[model samples]
Target: SRILLQDTSAVPTSPWTHFVMMAGSTLRKVKSRSWKKQRHFRLLEDGMTIWYKSRWAGKGHSTFSVTEVEAVREGHQSEVLLSIAEEFPADLCFTLVFHGRQGNLDLVADSPEEAQAWIQGVRKLIHKVQTMDEKERLDQWVWDWFQKADKNKDGKMNFKEVRKLLKMMNVDMNEDHALHLFTMADKSESGSLEIEQFVHFYKILTQRDEVWKVFQDYSGDGEKLMLEELENFLMMGQQEGERSAQLAQELIDSYEPSESGAMSLDGFQKYLCSQEGSIFKPEQRDLHQDMSQPLSHYFISSSHNTYLLEDQLRGQSSLEAYIQALKRGCRCVEVDCWDGSDGEPIVYHGHTLTSKILFKDVISTVKEYAFKASDFPVILSLENHCGVEQQTIMAEHLSQILGDMLLTTVLDGQVPQQLPSPQELKGKILLKAKKIGGLEDCIDETLTDEVSDEEEANGDAESPSAEDPPAESLTENDKVKPRKSKSKLSKELSDLVLYCKSVHFHGFEQARLHGKCYEMSSFSESKAKRLAKEAGTDFVQYNTRQLSRIYPSGLRTDSSNYNPQDMWNVGCQIVALNFQTAGLEMDLSDGLFRQNGGCGYVLKPDFMRDGNTQFSPEKPEERPDYKPLRLSIQVISGQQLPKVNQKEGSIVDPLVRVEIYGVPQDQAKEETSHINNNGFNPVWNETLNFILHTPELTLVRFVVEDYDKASRNDFIGQFTLPFTCIQAGYRHIHLLSKDGTPIPPSSIFVNISISELT
Candidate 1:
């Protein structure tokens, strides 16, 4: 079954060999300033390993495992910078980077086709190994169950024994179904089944059930679906007019094997598991949300501690973080400015071992990459820690780098009652920091008097008087305290805070009654939650005209993020998240913002923006005019599911979960199903239903997960869409990666139905 090739000389002649073999004399292994004097190399073990001979006698011969290869990409000849002591002429080479390898393995190929063959062959071999691993696990599971069900000392399982086995596997079988399986397995019409017969019976039973369920869901009456019905189901309102029927006919012709105009169960299953079966109509979709709302009226994509690539402390801070965050459509970035040893101010996590980058360099990077991905405004959440002198330099650098793009004055001549819309602030940068009412008010009167008197009486005052205590005589506790300095904002930076001026939140009443133009406030997650609980109505009312930001708590040293939906429910616009971490919370954030062409802004719903409406996240009251809608989702199957990672002997037990998030009454109602060991073509045949009170404000998310017995379930992929956008009927749901990019050829088949409740 398996064959190993030691070198290019001994090639296996078996056509059914487990691995493909390729031998070439031009192949040379290059590593670390020297080419292994090896001219002959052989790709063996299904491309999972490679062997090379240094001499004709194979004296210096070795092999390396290719299963742990990280990347295999094309390499240029110019990349060979070292002097080649050996006289060997190589045409082209490709590099292979392994997980724990010290240096890259560069192999020479005679032609482009040869290099491509190796690359493609290795990728296919890896996939085959993964498939075999999954098969082995499933086979072992079936054998264990068979052994347990044998009960008696016989090597075969009788009808009663088979029934018991079905019950243990959670399949409720009737006499008719039981007899059908027994007759199919017992080829000699015997009353018992041998081991081979049992295995064959188990595979057929699961496959047939899956096929029939899909057929029943599509075709009513449990028979084969007619051509017209198949066309209608696949179209599912995606195609328009008579063209849909024609397209459906074309699909049937391609998938259907028989001349009969009716589609069989096998044909139906094949079509459902293909890329053509996907229900996501990309053409009908459009970013039609209103973009004229005020900047505060939209939920912005924000990042907390944007400089840190890891933990809050002992993390490496770099300008590249800003570049990455901006490229990912983050409109709001945090900058913690502290005094650097050099004259320039630096950005880093204060009171920690985090590295620093020049504030000017950060500003320059932001200026270059700010509008590259999104043209909307960028809000610099400046956490000022530097003194007045360095703060002035920060303002100067921002002014010089940002030039005319910085907001130096109010959009209109007069201060409006509400903040300006994002459309009005397009391509502009806003600074958010503590507002210094006036420069003179920040200085202590005593310190000012001392300075003024010293300058007025130039050199006339004595260094020390007899009444003054001697410096050496005073103890540490008795020493005079140094005057504490107040933080002051320069006029240049203060002027730039035309819209995003940071202010302290006193209380609900004060902020509501006296909040003015450009006076925004921020809250930590804990404090924000507390405020939402105690004064939900007041917080929502205050945010109607002002902007509020919520960030992760200080206790989250791992730079983890809190759930943003809770904050969004309370009308918080800037709910900052740790962009570096990837998890369910980050997935939800990414899914929510995948709309509007990922411009990093989603408009708040009507109820939250309307001041006259009284809405609270803590309380729920029935809307007399608003009717509830029932949503039904049938989890069918998945196709070409991706592996979480490329490691040897890895398998995914995939499951699907449907979730609904909205107001308190319509809050997260989720139902999860069991996992199928077969990740490639898993069929759940489970139906989930939900009653949605606020369909307009609710979001529906479908998450695929991998079940693990000993650890938490790993996320496979997920896709989300607003409730209003979901179309009813048999449709395919295309899954998206955590970063919101479409994973091609990976999708889930589902039938969705929505009905209004009386």
Candidate 2:
């Protein structure tokens, strides 16, 4: 095995670090209580991977890398571990949580000391992996592949093993060319190469010709890029403008840099692949947008059924879900309340088998994580299904648990003509629920109010009947009524609703004449899409003053999501989707909110934010200041994509698809033809073009899928970014898994061109 560091002699070896590695132990691997089985597990000699096998199976062992683990949880942190709490002591149990929706591995140690040794040992390895530099990380990635390719476990790879490794890495190479590189790296007639030789082979194989071409264009000579050449490249090639010289010096010092202010081809590649070289503008990744506008003038990062970790009907309701959502910069989260078996109100899907959590617990979670991701306000969109008595209890919990974090009274002691800014409401939790009338209607002592708008508030006038939703391929159970008929509001809870008051969305004209800036309406996806289609200009105009929320349809029982960009195109602010579900829908939502400091709010374009704006999703071209852009993307190559198939001999044939989501005319996709038997480093020099109207609302999604003829293409990885954030230059797009988590080192190199469409 290859050493992770250059100097191993200087490092001291601790007893606890190797306790699990040197002396493998038998731990009880658990899923359900009925499925607990003893397994032999140990960390490998490389200290980067874990090997485990069922005690009963002679040669059926499985291995996963330490880098794959997102975190390590203790005791009953997971549902599976919680289920078997009675059988195992809390101190003796732990769970390994993998990244990107992979099921967790729950285990029970024979003793607390053994559990601690395993937990601490694994965590130490994880920390070391996390702190590695990009170059070191790349080295780790290569080592992982070497481990996988050395099938005989002889600590060396023969030509046959190297050839198979090429296929496993998703590379298709000519036999003679592969042999030439292999022989050169081997440097001996042994015909068997060790770990160092494999690393050398990878370096020779991955010489990025495309990046070298651009480097040569700017460099006086291809050997190195001096200060002047780098400055010019940043100015002309990367649009760095006035900061080009200073940024060039910074890049040179940061990446494979030199004190002499010169950058080699490798250093140049490193700079471009770094966050500074990403197609996304680094400035937009901070709090750059003006945040003082009224709440309705921005798009909010939101989640529907924020308490559910899985599907609605039977998923577990967890406080962790709320924490996850808030930590991901979700400024708005839905809480479906119900009358619990006890006096306290509980949160869960009303008419489903989903587990329940105490409402107070949810409130505590909200207070803790509301400002963790962003100091902006968090709207707790409450769907009240409880009686007046429990609703009062809910109010008490909200007041006591959230304390000062809850916004109980209106700012300025009275409702204003317009809503408050996210800047003004920072660190506060705003309640979004049915209120009696207006703020004046709420009396401190006399709190109960009549329920008058349930019918209208329940569904938009144009919303397809819940009983007959738009055609969606879903299980019957997904249609389970998520709430009860609207109940009267408790004065205590009603007072907490200062800004986001749920009301019926009447026609556009009615709202224009009588709408309160503090008033907001929730629309099912179908209704929102219909309104966006029928009244695109009006929808955009109305959103400027009052807030509009678009949620997934009731038919999404599987917790599926609709495209949020459609609603965003019409300037809808709170276009909520199932954060628990991962796909193109959530990708677009994450992409939009990913910028502006990830503060959970993105200011809409100037045209969309103006009260009298003529911007319309339907006729974007007709709007003033409609600078349509033609985007051409040259899909270069994919690096280190995750394997789609787990089987030993199954290599992937991948294809890249570039998709645009915006107004009707702007929504299109073009794809590259599949490359057969390659997933390691697939290349496709194909250019895809998109003409984008409403560029402010447009999102470009790059999807890499393993092509299959007999079945649906298997998803490899995807990346989504708003067109407005895209930088025109040679860039690297780091790809994410289906669940929107980074699959490290899996990225695509692309050449971007954006120009005026005229």
Candidate 3:
């Protein structure tokens, strides 16, 4: 039969329905937290199973269609099709869609001569599919569908018949999608698809089927289940048969002391509270019954599909409550920290929140909490809500309390020459660049005035935690004018580079820099390169838009994208020792790092940090909300959590909100306890694997649990982690699962080493 191709242009009436049917029976559903995407899809009745993705080493490709073919035969079929297409004559042309962004390919072969050229192009496509192992899996599935469309029991399929067959099979199978599949499949332009064509089409349908199944499973009975339903379901199999009845009676007895014979949800929950049988007990269930523990590895990249949690611990004080919250499994934590003008560090994240309490009181309160600093496992980002001096003072104070658990980060040259602890060098504190308005101009002033006073008085000029610089002193001429504030660009940049250089000079891993600037676009690539060369720094930060301008350009010899006239504009290499870019995008092209010849950008860690901005009333009506000091952190479990303790192929837990700063230390400390479905599992004894990814903390004590294999010799012994930012190496460790797998632990120790790179 002669084939006729037709194109249709309307949204599929039942995309989900059609997708489910096409994916096949095995796949359960297509579930994600992001908006779903739809593209033109084809429904080929041809017996050929289309291969879309690869699976396994060599099943040749996993065929999803009911049709079966020998592995050796399929391999030879693939070869023959590719070889014949190279010389077979065929006509090829593409049709432009009016107002359409994507052009449709139309290969018109009126005679054998033109058909031959078309076949050559087809050969290239076949060869490409053969070379990709993943594509093999896809090809096999497509072939299956083609086999089914061969209604005459013949080995070949024509589009005219295939289209009719798809309509009967409940697939829209319109002309455009069908013709696209056919054109790509028919290498010889004989206007007919041999068995190979069927194979490729089958693969495409199979994947659609799999994804459809997932969507249905997640949709669940066409009803949106409530939280209560989910909770009850989790307790379903916990207590079975007579034992369940006995527990129920016990619960009633505890609450119905007065013998009402009826109980409320609260009463029922309370009365049934036996450690051995309580439904709320962690051992009773996993996080949620429907959500199984993820088996994938760490999430090394960021995307819209990723999940983000909200800050829950808004107001609370009981350290116990905080600990319980942590046990609840949150990946992020925040705490209010203060630098008591006395150069003492206090754990508080706000200016107003701690106004009533002395910094020392905050410290003393933190000491009373049951959990030590080591118990918390998250990157602690601080906001210098307190002035820059206090932030520095607090850093010093924290350096002492945290010891090896702190990580230090300095942008350019803001840090001092010597720090007290080797743990500081380990990667605990970040000497981030705090760009003052017009900070560049303020540098000389900050150095000549602030630095001079501090040096002369050894930073004793003002109380390290002085509240406000006396508002009256801020009136225009008191120091530097607001508009005159400079970038602090050169100093901060140089400080980061110099610090990295100094640390590296000591034969240690180069210390990293946690660079920050509101206007990242202003942070040019040339400046960054110079900083890298001068200071030997690692890790730089950029917002989305800024990164696009600096993404490397591989071949800009004479392209409009770059100026070939300037060598610096062409073949630029933007290396991110440990780079991450966040914020707004100028365009989609900006987000494609690979296209620009650069590694991808990492999403900002959804963690808590201290934030401070002094606001002035420019006008009477411009008054803003007087927000007390506010600080928060992000926590993850198996999804957002950085790779720390994990099985070889298991997924990294999510980043949840386990704790927060600005709250009382006890409250902040308490948030970490209730994680991983209650009583923490001490199976993976591993430290956070990618410390450099978070260049903020100066010292870190990674508390991972090792499955107790009943062996005393479970430790992996001590090792060292050397980074570019810190010259001295931080001690590395493996708190392995008793069996050697990395897992969560009750607690562990980490020391931050901070010193000049050299």
Candidate 4:
């Protein structure tokens, strides 16, 4: 029986405490940089460091931090060949590459299980290190402040010292209020404030004002809100089924233990900032959206090079990539198919040293995990390089695995004049590939007699032509050339292309004239941007009826992604992004799709969907009736700002940037003044304003950055909300990490106001 090796690296597991024996060899330097063997490696310090013994007896051992390690399971040694000698089971061997201050260390494990264990242990330690680093920074910050405020070299601060510290923090407290706080903190009657008391006092001071402001906004009666008003506020924007007066009353009863049947400011604050009171409004999960519109009318969460987890050149491709992308609500996935050994088609990068997985396995995986995240249709963007025989095998695997879930024919027949809505094909998987259809028929008819005679003379045998060569037989040099061959899709495969038949995009005019339902075209990011610039209005008009996909250009070999909003601005539905990457681009993508229940589909704006509306990225002046809105934001201060690194005495010069993302003409941004040398309680009493035209479709993002004069500014935290959902008046903006999870106890206090122009 084959040993099973499940990919669990991406899955979160408890940190490992015990160590397992593992034999690995590391590369050491004999002279300047000559490679020499160093044997007998042991994972030490709970897998936080690796210590390897020198070859010489009684020699000193060198250690490297596991946090800097990069480990990967070895796949096929050769890309062009499929021989057993070059292929090894992933469970048998793996490699580890470590980057450290001394230099780089490359090592290889003797067994796969051992490598897997080491990698898992190292990852756990890395996470633990990061957590510890954060805690240590906070501790240091407390100590630094305590030492500074402890006048006369004392261990604690008296009321005068505490008052001085408050002043330094830009906080103003009346004498009576300060005395009350000092008395409350001096629990032991020592008449001095310790580090713990100081920290607790600061938290209370920051949280009180925020709570009162929120209460005043919701409680129209000024002091408190009635039970009915509190219930309405809690159930705001919730669907009718979810909004229950009883539930709201229960929440009020839990927070407000008063006989007056009213929620006080303190009670409201506790409920609003608690885990139960999420900033994101509750949305109904059922398909309540207008499913009658064509699939082209929705923006899809898509992935470019779905198999790659790193750089395109030598990144490892595995089934886990597919699983991760699918679980993240990616509706469209790419599969580069080529002929594999043993009559099975394989999926991988065509000419790189990347490993391959059986085409059938990919199909089976997709079938199992396709609808796990979303019930909407999945589009398999097939880049076929397989012969007719292997293509048939690929089709058989798909049909057998997916069964009736695979859309094999047009829904309701009648040659759909418009594409079917997502509701019409909920659990279906659509294949987007070139097929022998209308355009192919025209091309076949237009073929010159000389070419037809040559084909007839060869007895119509499917031999290897320059256009369709055996992919495996091509050498590295030959693979460099473009392999743009007409797909010889078999009847079985062509029949599966129900609603995503791939077509080459000619120009704006040609696509508008000849495009039909289920006929989709794709363009590289550069080409799409050029078309948008050159023919913005025509392109927008063309997308109203047909679907178009925009992918990253081949020049983005580093697996970096372009700003998908640029493509989205022109109303392109499927703007593919490199999901493996994490940056501003991916953040925007996540923010956009985070709406609509994160169902991997967002309905296109009404202006873009209307055929009669003449929308152009270039000619925003033409829309005379577009109302403009003035937005004013006051950046006040931040509470418990997170430390970016573990270094002591490190201070953050924080600045708040407000960005408005929408159409080209509607975009606007502004930044508040920076506060120097303060991560904890940095205050910038500056107001930034912007005039936005398309406020309804705009996204307002607040990004906090730590400014540095000698280096690039580092991201502190950020939060993005749709302009429509932003609440005005004094609001406590919760900061979120790069992955959109809220950072607890870290928030920014701000005032927002919006006014519409006549």
lDDT of each: 0.67, 0.82, 0.27, 0.66
Candidate closer to the true structure by TM-score (higher is better), 1 or 3 = 1
* 573-667 per-residue lDDT for model 3 (tens digits): 12211011111111111222211111121122112100111111111112233222212211121101123333322222211111111111112
Model 4 TM-score on a 0 to 1 scale: 0.69
- RMSD in angstroms between candidate 2 and the native structure over all alpha carbons: 6.0
Please provide, for model 2 over 623-644, each residue's C-alpha lDDT reduced to its tens digit, 9 standing for 90 to 100.
8677888899998888878888
Q: Residue 334 lDDT in model 2?
A: 89
Q: State the weakest 10-residue window (summed lDDT) of model 4.
A: 455-464
Distance (Å) between predicted and true CA of 343, model 4?
3.2
lDDT of 2 at 511: 84
* Candidates 3 and 4, the one with greater TM-score: 4
**Residue-wise lDDT of candidate 4 within 1-758, one digit each (tens)?**
01112232443533332346333444322221234354677664233557778677586776665545533323321211112323334444433433211222334455665555655655555555445433343444455556656757657788888877765543445778888888887788898877788777765665556456556766888888887767666554222135547766776777775767888875675565543353344442224467678887888899888887776777777665776678778999988888988898998877788878878777777886788778999999887778888988888988888899898766664577888898888998988876655433333444221212221221111111222233235455553433344234576676566677776554565566777767787777776787787777777778888888888877676889898877887888889888877677877787777677678888887778886668776666576556778888888778666767545446677889988887777777788878877666677878998887666567778898888878988898887766765655446677877655555457787766677865
Give per-model CA RMSD. 13.4, 6.0, 27.0, 10.2
Order of quality (lDDT) = 2, 1, 4, 3
lDDT of 1 by residue, 1-758 (tens): 01011111222234323322464445666653554445666674223456667667547767765444544545442133122423333325555644321244667666655655665555554454344432343454566568657767477988888876765553544679778878988997788998889988877775746557656766866667787777666565333346667867776787777888878776775565454554534422445567787776788999888887678878878664676678678999999988888889999888889988788878877887788767889999998777777988998998888899888766666656778888888898988876544222323212221222212221111111122232234454443233244234455555555677676555666666676746777777776777777777777777877898888877787888887877877788888998777666777676677667677888887777876557776664543346679998888777556777444235567888888877667766555565644555677878888988767667788998888888888788888776766756667787877655555446787877788886
TM-score of 2: 0.90
After TM-score superposition, the amount by which residue 653's alpha carbon in candidate 3 deviates from its true location, in angstroms, is: 32
Q: Could you tell which candidate, 2 or 3, scores higher by lDDT?
A: 2
Off by over 4 Å in 2: 1-15, 30-37, 74-90, 257-260, 443-487, 646-650, 709-711
